[model samples]
Target: MAASAYSDHPELCVKDNFKQSNFKRRIQVQCDLLKEDQCSAFTAISHSDKAIILSFRGSEEDEVTMEVVDAITVLPVTEFSGKAKVNQYFYDAFNDLWNAGIKNDFLSLKNANPGYELWVTGHSLGAAMASLAATTLVTTKIFPADKIKLVTFGQPRVGDKTYAELIDSIIPYAYRVIHKNDLVANIPPQFLYGYHHHKSEVWYNNDMTKGQPYLECDEDESKKCSDSVIDLSIPDHSMYYNVTGSFASNGCKGWNVFTQ
Candidate 1:
């Protein structure tokens, strides 16, 4: 579903793409696309898992999203309790997409599905939005925080220490999958801007080739994971598992490798 968001037309990626993917029979896209300020995502219903998968498209080749990717400044997570703060740009973009149409679409889907769980995933910029969505969805009573399952690749910091703590306390199944030396995962500088990552990090220390080992960090922001890398690379941000190249280049191929 994440790959589908990159297509020139929603049907090409959302419908046709899913037909060719591994989860074709198990999951189906209900909403082709949701967009506001280049923040794109889609809603998918999984019959086997009885869940709703909200997959956000990663960064675009535009300046507007690039600015938000900077991860500077902060905004309050109004739905979440306590003094939780997040990246102003990310929060706005998430809210923009959510308010534009995701709310109604999601609510309708949830009502139809009834007891379905919420699952969110993304990469790069989309990863940040996924985090915010997970938190907001919980605080708004859309889903019990514990029922929302989140697994994002190359996720960057979405909020401050308190917010990170909220995620740790709220969601037990959340996991941030950071490929070895993913530069995007290091942005917003923890020391400089005071942004912090949530708990449960799954760090791939190698090239993420088949048979390669990965570490489930013992710490929320474990230095022993990708943070220990001697060098970081931007290209690393684009590939996860067997999925490789830019979003357009993938053509929605190789998703089975990661989805499994």
Candidate 2:
């Protein structure tokens, strides 16, 4: 679904993704892509399996970072009762997208699919949005934390230690998938900026190919995993699961178009 999020027409790309997968049953792509100048996401559902997916699209470096460079300060989030502080830009971006439209579409999807599991994912900047989205869903009582599964790739630090722990405690199944030395994963220079990632870092020790070795570090920003890499490379950030493209079905290693 993360790959599907990149398409101009997600409804068609997602169906193409499902068709290419191993599942015996297909998912329902109920809407077009959720896109804006700064962020984008796509939603799909499998009624038979009682599951829903919200996949956010990665952004170009220049476009996403511009929002951060100007609003680099960290601020206490109102939703967390001023307890957890986060990058003001990340916070604003999430709220802007949520209040603008994603919230209503999400709520409607939930109401229509009772007992369905929520699976959220993204890459790069989209990873930031996905992190906030999952946390918001739980904080707003939209879904019990346990019912949501969040797995992001090349995820940067979303907040400070307190905020990371809050996300950790709430989203137990969260996993930040980092390719070996993904430059984006080391953003804000860690402690220098007081930003930290959440727990369970899934690090692919080598090139992330079908049979490559990987590790799951239970500590947030674990030094024992991807954090251990001394040399960081930006190119590594764009090739999750061994696919190579900017941020679409092409990145997932295959492409096809179908009329909806």
Candidate 3:
């Protein structure tokens, strides 16, 4: 798929201001799932189209907590327990949200929308949750594996080789969008922890100007892909929609990019 096709959806998913009081003013349906110290997510029907979007929010004040969650390594998908495993923390967080009613709400919205498509997305931690949710939905038969469109920004590796193969085969339209030097995309380091990413990565160059190259690397764990490298700085991870003149202008604070 073209970069334009995948890029547009994530832009919409990450652009929301997330003001709870007036969330409906921004998106059609706002279903908030926040458990202090657990997980955070919201499901909304698009204001302009018939798409049901489930977006996850990254660590706000608990960076250390999220880091710990990332270190939990792989755990099997509850349904396919012995056969497939995913990042334990991401799956746990997503499981919390699913149990809290995202599944029912998602089905209700799908039935109401009739012909609308289902889109699952997020950035950083949200991206991880989105990946978990997308994969789980497929395994549970809540939604057809082929119908879910997943586009994540700054998403970390969410599973091992088996989990990656399962999702890559089931979700053909899954796109992992990584921007230049986005450090979050590189963790929990594949070499150190045996984590792996799904196929079809859309990598954007550091340049913000038009005509900058966006390459789609087909290898599942190639060094040519962004996740294979490590750069501690998080500026590029949060620069999907907003492009700063230079890294100095934003730096690690780029996490604020999506909200504005």
**Please, what are the lDDT tens digits per residue for candidate 3 over residues 23-49?**
111111122233345445555666455
Q: Write candidate 2's Cα lDDT for 22-137 as tens digits.
A: 22122222111323345666667756557777777766655545534433444434447665767765666666666666677777778877888988888876788799999888
Off by over 4 Å in 1: 9-37, 62-65, 73-79, 245-254, 258-260
Residue range with the least summed lDDT across 10 consecutive positions in model 1: 23-32
The better candidate by TM-score, 2 or 3, is 2
Q: Report the poorest 10 consecutive residues by lDDT, candidate 3.
A: 21-30
Cα lDDT tens digits, model 1, 1-260, are 55455444433344333432222111222211323335677676665667777777667555324454456544435446555878876777777777766776777777887887888877777788889889888777778776688988888788878888888877788989988888888877788556888878898877787788998985568887877775977777777775642554435444455455
lDDT of all the models against the reference? 0.69, 0.70, 0.62
For each of the candidates, give the backbone clash count: 0, 0, 0
Candidate 1: residue 164 Cα off by (Å): 0.6
RMSD in Å for model 1: 5.1
Candidate maximizing lDDT: 2
* TM-score of each model, in listed order: 0.82, 0.83, 0.73
